[model samples]
Target: MKQRAQGSAGAGTPPGDARVPAQPRPADAPDGFRERDTAVPAARAARGEHTHSERPIPEPRPAVQRSSVRGQILDALRTALVTGELKPGEVYSGPVLGDRFGVSATPVREAMQQLALEGAVEVVPNRGFRVVERGARELAELAEVRALIEVPVMLRLARTVPGERWTELRPLAEETVRAAGTGCPATYAESDRAFHRALLALSGNEQLVGIAADLHRRSQWPPVRRGRAYLVADAAEHMALLDALISGDVDGVRGLVSQHFAGAG
Candidate 1:
């Protein structure tokens, strides 16, 4: 045993105890680390995904939100529309909807008009527009029409689009599943609509995009277990489409999409 460092020894008797001094950390050692050895590849691997050579520092992403009163109103109305809270061919009065929102008729009227324009509601003679009533036949027609106009385009675009681009839609697809499982008709409906919209959006046809929106509006029905069924199948369908697209097999993608519409009928 060696003598300890001199300090408050006047008050103590022990002088033979050796001072256990901490070794100084190397300059390259980050906090919580002891040392860095550049001589071995394993040491470099232990540091991180990159060596002392090169690495990518990811840029921070900006927060996204639904902003603007009109946008918010549209969102709320879309929720109502999808939830089947608004029935087909049923009229929603400006004042009634306004009261439901605890707001004035101005916003409700605006929302109603927008929905009507989207074909979610139809104008009646000497009366307000009814949320467009879709019969089984109408739904079948819509499913078929969409498969016709959108499927080929989706197939083509899917090939050109990278897996990463498709990945951006994965969250929306997952949300559709959650919405269906939880029986959240409103959320389920919006996310369901988004799933298709995202697929069509891959084509970059704004006019065709408008047609898709109209079809969705015309496709609405009362909340039913079938809606959930449709959502689940459609979610899986989206993944299948992506898979075929990634593989660069357009014909296979088209056939699957066509089969889906056949099932829709």
Candidate 2:
């Protein structure tokens, strides 16, 4: 038998020895990844979406008397989640979100804690948080809850509030329908939220308004796409509810709200 080469593999010396030299990485390898990171901003510029450094980055605005950076981050996160930018069931870290918001992880974490309380996300120990998935069943349950709360309030308002007050809100309600008619989801969502908020504001209970607003925002999770005809039908329903309130038909208002919730689900 031929003798093994000297120093190649003495007994007990493993093949592919630990002392083997590492091959040089290619020029396009991840070793120089930061240089390639600029491509994203360049592409955004091409598409007319200016990069952060291109535009003036303003300092965060003051909230009430003090600067609440955590609140701002929470609001931003909520917007992102509602718009489907932060997809349901996908995990996101504080550092990653902090980088996106141009803030620190501390505020991002604080905001995430609030989101956990709202049932918008679930925290994963040692990992991060993920947006909660809301299925059709969950949405239907929310609609039911909304009907239970809103129908009674609307009934009272119809009986007590003057008819002219509802008529005055006609323009705003119509604007919401117009927004839906335009087929812009964001516009319709905001206008729809505004309409509900305005209606609830008449209650003169800030706490009630806040709770209803939270439910309204939550119900919008996983937005469903309906045809223009559907939107028109929904708008008509809103108008009918207003008419019932104007006519002081408490029974009619209740019936209309029930029908609206049924149709919505």
Leading candidate by TM-score: 2
Evaluate residue 153 in candidate 2 and report its C-alpha lDDT on the 0 to 100 scale: 82
Alpha carbon lDDT of residue 137, candidate 2?
A: 91
What does candidate 2's lDDT look like per residue over 130-244, in tens digits?
Answer: 8899888998999888888887887778888998988888877898789768765556667777878888788888998888878877887666656667776777777888888
Q: Write the per-residue lDDT of candidate 1 for residues 99-202, one digit (tens) a residue.
A: 78776666777776777777677766666668766667777887788777877787778568877787777777677667767656676667767877887888
Those runs of model 2 whose alpha carbons end farther than 4 Å from true positions after fitting are 1-68, 225-229
Each candidate: RMSD to true structure?
16.2, 20.6
Query: In model 1, where do residues sit more than 4 Å from their true spots?
Result: 1-70, 124-127, 162-164, 221-227
TM-score for predicted model 2 compared with the true structure: 0.67
**Residue 156 in model 1: lDDT:** 73
RMSD versus native structure for model 1: 16.2
Worst 10 residues of 1 by lDDT: 60-69
